[model samples]
Target chain A: MDVDRLNLPSDGDGPVFKEPWEAEAFALALGLHERGLFTWTEWADALAEEIARAQGAGDPDQGDTYYQHWLAALERLVQAKGVVSETELTERRDAWERAAHSTPHGQPVILKP
Target chain B: MSHDNDDHGHDHRSSDNHWSELTLRVKALESLLVEKKLVEPAALDAFIDTYETKIGPRNGARVIARAWSDPAYKARLLTDASAAIAEFGYTGRQGEDMVVLENSAKVHNLVVCTLCSCYPWPVLGLPPVWYKAAPYRARAVREPRAVLAEFGVTLGGDVEVRVWDSTAELRYLVLPERPAGSEDLSETELGLLVTRDAMIGTGLALPVASLSKRGCP
Candidate 1:
């Protein structure tokens, strides 16, 4: 099937990644879809909802933090899907913050027990 | 001990604000997904790796190569990029209604999404963070030459720049003019010279000599 509706912005440039983390975020969404955790349509709907919600909250929708909203939608759906609880998600987020702060320079910040 | 590494030394305070915060949230979400067995970290890594190197830019490179080497194909790509791209089975979500913009000696094309980071995933994959940032989005349309200069792209004074605003209905891709002395190069070799930035108008395609020096596959 031809997806004639997928209109993304580009100057015919190859997939240029500005940062490492953005790639990770893109992969996460694709990975989740590959694992059958969600369909692209579902993901699209969720992402659209999140964007709408952000706009309603006066996000300005200037194209920055688009992935932030993407991650937010992923979190909401994963939580709703029973993959994780809201409390657990927050705890883990805090843990990463701590890990990032504690880890040395030029090293990966992995969570530890 | 201060958690201030030389690498992440810039903006320690604001660092915790945008990218870092989103990163932590994503990491947390990944952990939760993994814990629930809904997703595997390995699968995630593989997926990212695939897009990072294997399947993304190269696909676009092939398309660009074809257009460069074949005038008829080039005409088709400029006329109907979506249909032309589908010939190679590169049609999918976020790639519908692709409009190929041709760069020439007189006109240069740049693209941006003012509303969101709607990128052509089928051929280009995910967009760079800067492309999705407010600074680039805001400045690209207002002062394209300045933004391009920041990216080290300085157009000739004689060349006019056209900025395409991407919406949900139309996506823009740039088909850069073939570099000089590339006439003898094969399609594969031409593809090698075509970089993501070249297509995005931030940089020119690599010269044939540098193409081999770069050790691209």
Candidate 2:
């Protein structure tokens, strides 16, 4: 099937971002592709699997979740590649949350030293 | 780096819900990528920094200033925004099918993507959190006046408020009406007066005096 037929917002010309995180996610995905970490075909299949999973789990199927699925696929691919274990990923996430919560509003959130 | 899962138990608290889950997912992926040498932390910071500070509403400000200074350019901008904006090399993924909305004395324009968070990235770097949240999306279409008021924008009753719902295929950028006493200002000066919210139609460009007071050169 043609990827364009997927009709995802990110597929064509449209607003690039609705939030900073979204842009970060977009850049991360593009960066990964550039580094040869995953082929576009692999990326697409992973993303498709994620969206399919979400749909099966009752995701409304709106474009609102397009990026969420993208992020999930990224995580799955990286884990599958053995670049990082799920345990390490979770620990880093908790660390970030602690750091972010401690940071003041309007200030850039940084990981604590 | 090998992950020792036996010692560390999963923290269900961090991945239990929506926002938290998303944040953790992004953070985890970032750290993993960095550890694998697939991406540099500094490089990612630089990329995010470019969008956050270096390249942003300022680019759109220049476009608005040029349109204000040149009538023909304004016409071109309204007729075919993509080509006109590409004249300055602001063409990309989110800006391919660009539609320029001119804020007039009689008609005020506001943009939102009710279905999702679609926004012009070439000119405007990213959508603010409020623009992406459920409240703003639902209210912007249902109660634009209230939403605009929350943003400190009060349109006169006589001025028609036209809210444009951005979609995946097309995006809208508002060309805010030039402020009074800005006629004598240079194009570059006019650009300085334009704000990010002005192009989004949520706020107007600052006055020349205010711009000067804000230390804008």
Candidate 3:
């Protein structure tokens, strides 16, 4: 699925969804990362661990749905990793929203190109 | 050694101008957060992560694809859109009232969140980065024809592009006319041409191809 044109930067070249799994997996990792529950390293390890566990559990979907794994990985990484508290994360979100949408330059739309 | 590659020659003047004009308030708030140390850089990084990666095109694609296949459903979609979308299990907190407008020989529909970029969230998922900003919200209604031109879509006098303002309470979807020579395609196959932008009324569904060229994006 193409990203909505309205959602893109005014100067973005084009929307690209070259691979289907990319977006779902990205969203899962992002949701966990937003809460600050895992470091980049931990996020990687959690995904690998989830893959192993899914394989062991005889998951038929296999590698197709890393998003599912991503969600599961986040659920565990949050409690086990102890990177950030829920309340702390909420506070951060509130602050980010303040910063991200506060004014005309709050969030950088051209972050990706 | 310090090394940096500034490969892109994007107009910083324009980007900066746009950024300053639209995100000044957001930047101010971010500065305040930095002052207080409430949001860690890591947390902020993750926020962007979900924003771009997790909440993505699949959500919007599903809506556009569905509308292409079902006309009676599309009719209901325009009549009481939010309720009709519920049939496909697209209802949720994010999805508010959504209206699906069908484009035909006589009428064409385009949607913009003119007042503040409020959109049909449930069916489309999270709004895109551009949609929520100031320029698109303001210019889309005032100069829709010009804006469409920016996207390389032109309408003739035979067709009328009616611009609809999407709100939190009422949102709109454009049911693009089904392409020619696609009568034999499956539901999923036909869905491919239903681009996310088309559903949001920025463009038309990609025209279909003959049998040999089926499955082309």
After superposition, which runs of candidate 3 have C-alpha atoms over 4 Å from their true positions? A1-113, B1-55, B210-217
Candidate 3, B124: how far from true, in Å?
1.8
Instruction: Please give, for residues B77-118, the per-residue lDDT of candidate 3 as tens digits.
Output: 677776776777666443246667888878878887654445
Per-candidate total of colliding backbone pairs? 9, 1, 22
* Candidate 1 residue lDDT tens string, B61-152: 89999999999999999888999999998886432489889999999998887656666767777676566655666677888887777666
All models: lDDT?
Answer: 0.74, 0.74, 0.56
Greater DockQ among 1 and 2 belongs to: 1
Top model number, DockQ: 1
For each candidate, what TM-score against the reference?
0.63, 0.62, 0.50
State the RMSD for candidate 2.
11.2
TM-score, chain B, model 3, is 0.68
Candidate 2: interface RMSD equals 10.3
Check candidate 1 and list the clashing pairs: A6-B94, A6-B95, A6-B96, A8-B119, A9-B118, A11-B174, A12-B173, A12-B174, A14-B196
Report the CA-based lDDT of candidate 2 relative to the real structure: 0.74
Q: Give the TM-score of candidate 2.
A: 0.62
Candidate 2 docking classification:
incorrect
Clashes of 3: 22
Candidate 1 C-alpha lDDT tens digits along A4-63: 112224444444445566666777777777777776657767877787788789875554
